[model samples]
Target: MVDSVKVAGIQMEPKILEKELNLERCLDFIQTAARQGAKLLVFPECALTGYCFSSLDEGLSVAEAIPGPSTEAIASVCRELEVYVVMGLLEKSGNKCYNALAFVGPEGLIGSYRKIHLPYLGIDRFATPGNRPFRVYDTPVGRVGLNICFDVRFPESSRVMALQGAEVIALPTNWPKGAESAPRFIVHTRAYENRVNYIAVDRVGVERGFRFIGQSKIVDYNGRTLAEADVSREEIIYADLDLKATREKRVVIIPGEFELPLFEGRRPEFYGLICERGESVEC
Candidate 1:
């Protein structure tokens, strides 16, 4: 496995109900990023099918199967370029539809992560909640975890991936206007706390009266901003990630006077309340 790899995040605007156009645009970006030496390229949430659907029927209409046409096209590109790609798309499985992210390598479809936490905003309101557990996949680059959009709001999501030895967490998001602070603070917080590379790729442009804030970015394991895209424009941000750094979880401040072990020091017993459902507990 390589110790370091170049990654890119594509920030673009997708037209609503125009799956064909969006797919074409995504293919272009994939080729461009791959040409620029990005081994792992990430795209925004709903990159293939736009978000903000009015009903489940609307989402299902454009939703495609995970290994269907869209993925086959992407897999062909990956094979040609010898790179890896993580993209967001609405998945249709029988009568159910879910917000999902697909991981594709040069070989073919690697894995997928369906959004587990559904929010009231956008298509997630009408889409089916994901049933799969959080997982990390071993790849040529490093141990990678996948999560979409609102999943980052819940610390447990990334924490679970971090616990599973994920070195890079790829997040495909569709952040809207008035949500600027998400990339500014929360993204960095997740990277710092978990000591894993966090790549959040967001879409831009207004769709059906709702505006999306771009600001797609990639943060290193030490919480440093490697690259960030413009807020209102379509662009690509690139960063070279060192996989070895993510494996070093120990922090030594002042040479032992202040030491912190991020993963080894967790107290699972006290954190059990986090898994409780249907009841609110006072802190």
Candidate 2:
């Protein structure tokens, strides 16, 4: 019901294998952002537990159930601050481990999204692929969707959420040194293509010798950079996002002449190949 929401992206480093320390850091950041009138706060991928684990056992060590102690702690803080947060952490389900983002609010645990696309680097190399379908959670802030680090690379993920009426997509990512192009191009491209406000929060500092690029960014529905962080510092970037404006997919520059009905002009019938998989389905 809110027309606009102030979003904050916390760009901080998580210590490897230090769950308690990371949780403390997250609480500190949450308090700081909430006090600043930020309605929605997003943290980097594995912000509760650092990425680049050597093995699945190691990841599972810090990994917890979605609504377990860590999320409960966050929910308590959210209740006091009256805010919403999307934070990344490793998830342990039975014998499998997954890289996930938990969406918590003042009420309680809203939902969680597991990383569907598993890149061959860091903990993702060993984590189980996400099993659930993409979902958009309607909250006090807006219709918010969740995605992890590698999931941003796939256009289908964002498109799916956009089709589900998601106004904002919170992407908690851990971008290393070689993945500079993601923040530079992909974040804004996804925002423009989907007409949804996109916030990508990335971590800083080195974990296991892999230096993460901390260029956390917040882009509007029009793909404009509202706020951005530096490459190697711990910082918080803020943006006042217009949720109502994101829902207006039809853009009229000259009223009758230069009108762009982005969603209305979609040709899903011809885009069947996007849903097809396997090597048999040729490009």
Candidate 3:
């Protein structure tokens, strides 16, 4: 297993309802990133199909099944380049449509993550909530986990993945203008609290008049920002992550004088309210 790996995040604008064009753009980015020595390349949410869909039917029109045409094409590229690619798309399974991210490696389609926490925005407003549990995909690059746009707001999402031994968590997001705080603070907070490397890839450009904020970034396990992109542009950010360092959750500052045993110090028994579903009551 490689302890050190270079990762890249592609922040680009996707034309709404243009699957083929978006796929071509994704392919171009994939080739460029791979050539630049990135083993893991992550794209923004709904890179294949644009967000801000007017209806569920519209989302369904472009949604495809996992291991479908897109993943197969991406897998072929990965096979040729020996790289891993994670891109967001609308997924159709049975009678439900989900906002999802597909993890494709050189081997083939590794797995996919449905957006569990769906905010009332874009395709998620009409899409079905994710039914599966949060999963961490163990790859040659590292133990990688995935989260969609709004999932980052819920700390439990990242906590679960971190507990499952996720060395790197990729967050494919489509943040609009009002969501400036997310890129400024949330990414670092999640990485610091979980003691895992985090990458939040967001889109750029206006979609149906809703402009996306393109502050895609890569943060280290200790909450340090390795690379960050501007707020409005198409760009690729790279960061060399130390997978082995992320495994050492115990941060010994001055030989235990000020140490933080992240997971080991968790007191889960007292955090029961987090899992309890109940009527909203002012505490």
Candidate 4:
């Protein structure tokens, strides 16, 4: 595995329900990020269809097929530049619609992650629920995880990814403006607790009634904010991540059945008593 990889986070507002214009901007940004020596690039959530749009009709009308035009365009870039890309899209799955994150590598369409933990605001009304909470994909840079806008708030999302061997958790977000501080703090906490790198990409401009906060950030395992962009500006945040740095700092065993199966031997029966109290609340 490579010791270090250069990555970039794209921060720009998307057009309201305009797929053509949004895709044009996506291609342009991909090229720009590629020129900046970015081995991996990430975009904000609901990039295909502007976030906060009124109806499922809008998401459905703009929804694309995986490996469809959106993925195809990015695939060409990945193939041509040999760089990996993670982008957000609206997916029209049978009988349901999903807010999905796609991972494209040089080999073509790598895998896509559907957004779990939909926000109670408008997304729950406009989008369908995801079956799984977290997804990790293998890439040249290392194991990469995908979590859409609201997934990281739960902690279990990032924890599962890190336990699953994800070196970096790339979040595609479209955070609302005026609330930048809290989200910034949250991403760092996720990274700090998991001992993994966290990259969050968000948009800058306003669409419909929602104005996005544009401070795309990358945080290290020590809860350090490595780089952050301004909340109202359009810019790319770039950084070179040393993959080995995470392993050296990891000292805890956060065990989960899906990703951290190594902890299966650990006193689950002993811990079951503790979980029973919380299980009623969770279920």
TM-score of every candidate: 0.97, 0.98, 0.98, 0.88
What C-alpha lDDT values do all the predictions have? 0.92, 0.94, 0.93, 0.80
Candidate whose TM-score is highest: 2
The list of candidate 3 runs beyond 4 A from truth reads 279-283
Give the lDDT ranking, best first: 2, 3, 1, 4
Worst 10 residues of 2 by lDDT: 274-283
Clashing pairs in 1: none
In model 2, which runs have C-alpha deviations exceeding 4 angstroms?
Answer: 279-283
Clashing pairs in 3: none
Residue 112's lDDT within candidate 4 is: 88
- Number of the candidate with higher TM-score, 1 or 2: 2
Off by over 4 Å in 1: 254-256
Clashes of 2: 0
Residue 144 lDDT (model 4):
91
Identify the candidate with maximal lDDT: 2
